[model samples]
Target: MVIMKKMWKNNQARRSVSQLLMAVVAILLLGYLSSFVYFRLDLTADKRYTLSEPTRSLLKDLDKQVFIRVYLEGDMPIGLKRMRRSIKEMLDEMRVVAGSRLAYDFVNPSEEKDARLRQEFHNSLMEKGLKPVDVVESKQEGGTDTRRVFPGVIIHYGSKNIAVNLLSNNPVLSSEENLNQSLQALEYKLMHAISSLVADTVKKVAFVEGHGELGYLDVLDITDELARYYEVYRGFIDTQSPNLDEYAVVIVARPTGKFTEEEKFILDQYIMNGGKVLWLIDAVTVNRDSLSTGETTLALVNETNLEDMLFRYGARVNPVLFKDLQCALIPVNTAPAGEQPRFVPAPWPYYPLLAPRKDHPITRNLNFIKAEYSGTIDTVGTSQAVRKTVLLVSSRYARLVRVPSFISLRQIDEKPVQEEYNQSFQTVSLLMEGKFQSVFTHRMTGKYALPPGKTFREQSLPTAMIVVADGDLIRNEVRGRGSNPHPLPLGYDRYMQQTFGNKDFLMNAVNYLTDDAGLMPLRVRELRLLLLDRARIMESGTFWKTCNLVAPVLLVVLFGVLVNIIRKRKYGRPEKFG
Candidate 1:
């Protein structure tokens, strides 16, 4: 009986060993296959882990290795830690498709042992255009600790490098929402840089000159920014030959002079051929220089000659100035005329802080756009083919001052009456898309004919254009006089010491207009923040902690006791019964 029992035990042990060996072999096979076959299941409700189609396309076509150095490592706030994990997950998913073509490493700038070396490293990053954010954390034992954190990345593709600041500092949004916005924009920003850097043939964009458009100096900052992604040019429209075939996009920024018939025809034909245009026009003319002298300026109708052309296309910039209670502040001399001028900052109604349309990708989550002597935009034209979207509008308390009117600094003293400023939500910026009917469709005479071989298209190929009623939206402030002058960043207010969203809006507009890969739509992705209730945690801190600490151990103990009882019932029973 003892010998028979020993043999039975050995047979049972051999079966157990065989099952274990098979399980090990299956695991090994799975690990080997996983190396070649990469797949991840994104069970997220928002699909936040999944890469957009455009981004995947961009990555799949990368001929050269793109190395990214992310500086978001080390000790950070819980929000930043979450962002860091997200960045890693995003890069991991990207690497699944890109293989070795995409590589990234997290770097903690504060990891340096020496203080001076760390400072130098931070400075180098700043020079490369990576903005460093100062974070203050409260200690458990005492006061707050301050540290400069760089939530940015430097991407290198071949010989060129691009710096991208990952954090979005929208003053209007709370910190959590701002971080969420930054995370939402990560794919767009990274793919934009990659697309710009990996392109073998760089596309060209032109700033149309010849008409009294904003000068090179006035648009220096924006020009520099756009140069990173496009071959930027400044030249007069070729009225004689009238061919803009080489340029992908053309910008007509705040042209004070009139557009000639030939010039308008060229622009119209260019759009007809699937080209993009950004039109920043002011219908009313104001001597902005006169305001600096603390005097009233005559706001007259500035005849740019393109009004009729634009009206026919889809939009009209009215001959008026927009005034909003939600406006920017300007320095006003509070002291009497003779006394030492006490220039105090006061709300300037003419400088309307236009609200961005939340629905559109171009202006989504953008800060208030600052405009000087802006005019209202009216969507005209009933063509179903042409789609017009209002991208920017004035606040609830907006008033339109008619042209041939006086705009005086003395008006600051008079309190704004709620009844007078009744015009609410006036459109100041518009985006027109789809196949635009040519303005010169029926009116194209021999003078408007293109140079040989090219036929005039009465209807445009599917294209887009943005018309902003404010010209000064693209203009930056110059600090010094003449030769030594330095231009501040676009949307920066010197008096307020704050930068508005003008630059971002323009960049977004240009990006949307020129986006061929359909990358702009990815900007619309949103991740809902499911935050833990702080009050509940504070109230039941110890209770939850005890549950978290003891529940798992109790579960394991109960599972072990159940397993032991099953073993006793099956194997410890009397052999005589069997």
Candidate 2:
């Protein structure tokens, strides 16, 4: 009987061990299979956690490692802390798609105890093109403390490194709104940096130089900025055998002279072949230098002769100047001459500060774009094949000055009625996309002779173009002596000491036009920020505090009691065996 009991216990022990081993084996097999499959659920209402398709594809196709150094670290404000968290989460998601190829680190450059070391670090970062932002923190018992922080990232891939500014600041937006816009743009900025660094071949862009367009010196600032991404070329289009097809984008910046029929035909053919163009044409011409003479200058319509071509493409640059109440200030000489003149900043109605459209990707979250004698743009044609979007527009308090009107600096002294400046939302810049009908379609065979092996395309392939009614949008201000002039940054007003959004607006326009992978659409992603009313919060602070502190615990206790009661009813019954 003792042997039988011992044998039975041993058998039971063996059965238990066998079952345990099988269970372990099954768990291991399940885990191994799961390693090959990937799945995730994003519960965010705005789909903030979800990676864009372009981003995912870019990550998955990475052949080599991409190292990122994020400088948004250490002690920071709640806003910055949240930005850091979002960046980390984005990088984590990227890593999943890119596997071990995408690596990143959060670095705190201000952590150095040595002042000299910290200064050197900051200088190095600045040299690497990372702009530092001054962060001011209000102390509980003191005034405030200021610290310099770089909310930027450096992306390294292969033999290249590109710096990306993560903070998108708009002077028009509130601090919170600016931070939210920056957060919204985080993905595009990072992806753009990555794409720029990883590009295998450099794309080509050309600035059409003939026909009295803005000279090389005038556009030097934007050219310098664009050279980072494209192999920029400055030359006249060869109308005899137009080789414009070699370039991805062509810029006609403020062409003052008329384009010959042959040249226009060549340009039209280029557009028909899916070529992109940025037309910064001035409809009304006014010599701004004449304003310095203290005399009125006649602002006449500029005759480029490309109006017909542009009209066929879906927009018209009207020969009317826009005057906005919200405009840049110029330092007017309020004092008499000979003595030191007191230059006071006065609003120059001719120099309208345009607001970017919030609905479009090209202008979303952009700051005010300064314009000098800019004209209005009117969308034409009712073609379903063409889509036009107003990218920049004047404010509600705007007025239109028809061509042949005189512009004088003395007008700044005149206090105009606000009711007179009631022309609202006048379009100044437009983006046109889709298949464009060639201006020389039927005329090519009849009037213009086509080269051998060349065929006239009546309709264009899918393409895009931007039309700005102001030529000065692409022109930069020059400083220094007359013999050796140096270009100031584009959209910079020396008198006001402010930088506008002309450079960014133009860059984004070109980027959108040349982008083949549709990455520019990523700029439209928006994350809405829900903020509490500060006044209400302060007024009902105790009531809210009590609810936040006690509500969860009370709910937990209620749930426990309900579960216990259900359990008692479910299993606390006397069982009768059959």
Best-fitting candidate, scored by lDDT: 1
lDDT for each candidate structure: 0.89, 0.88
Put down candidate 2 lDDT per residue, 1-578, tens digits, no spaces: 65765666668668868999999999999999988766669998999889899999998888899999999999888888888998998888888899999999999989999999999999999888798999998999999988888999989998888788898777777888988998888888888878877887778899997799998889999998888778899998776666888899999999999998988888888899899999999998897778776678899999998999999899999999988999998778788867787778889988899999987889988889999899999999999999888899999999988879988889997998999999999999999999999887656355554445667888999999999999999889888838899999999888777789999999999899888666888898988889889999999988999999999999999999999998677545444435
- Estimate, for each residue in 387-430, the C-alpha lDDT of model 1 and write its tens digit: 88999999999988887998889999999998899999999999
Off by over 4 Å in 1: 1-38, 139-144, 448-452
lDDT of candidate model 2 versus the reference = 0.88
**Which 10-residue span in candidate 2 carries the lowest summed lDDT?**
569-578
Q: How many steric overlaps are in each model, in order?
A: 0, 0
lDDT of 1 at 312: 80
Candidate 2, backbone clash total = 0
**RMSD per model, one decimal:** 2.5, 5.0
Candidate 2 residues lying further than 4 Å off, grouped into runs, are 1-40, 139-143, 444-453, 481-486, 494-497, 550-578
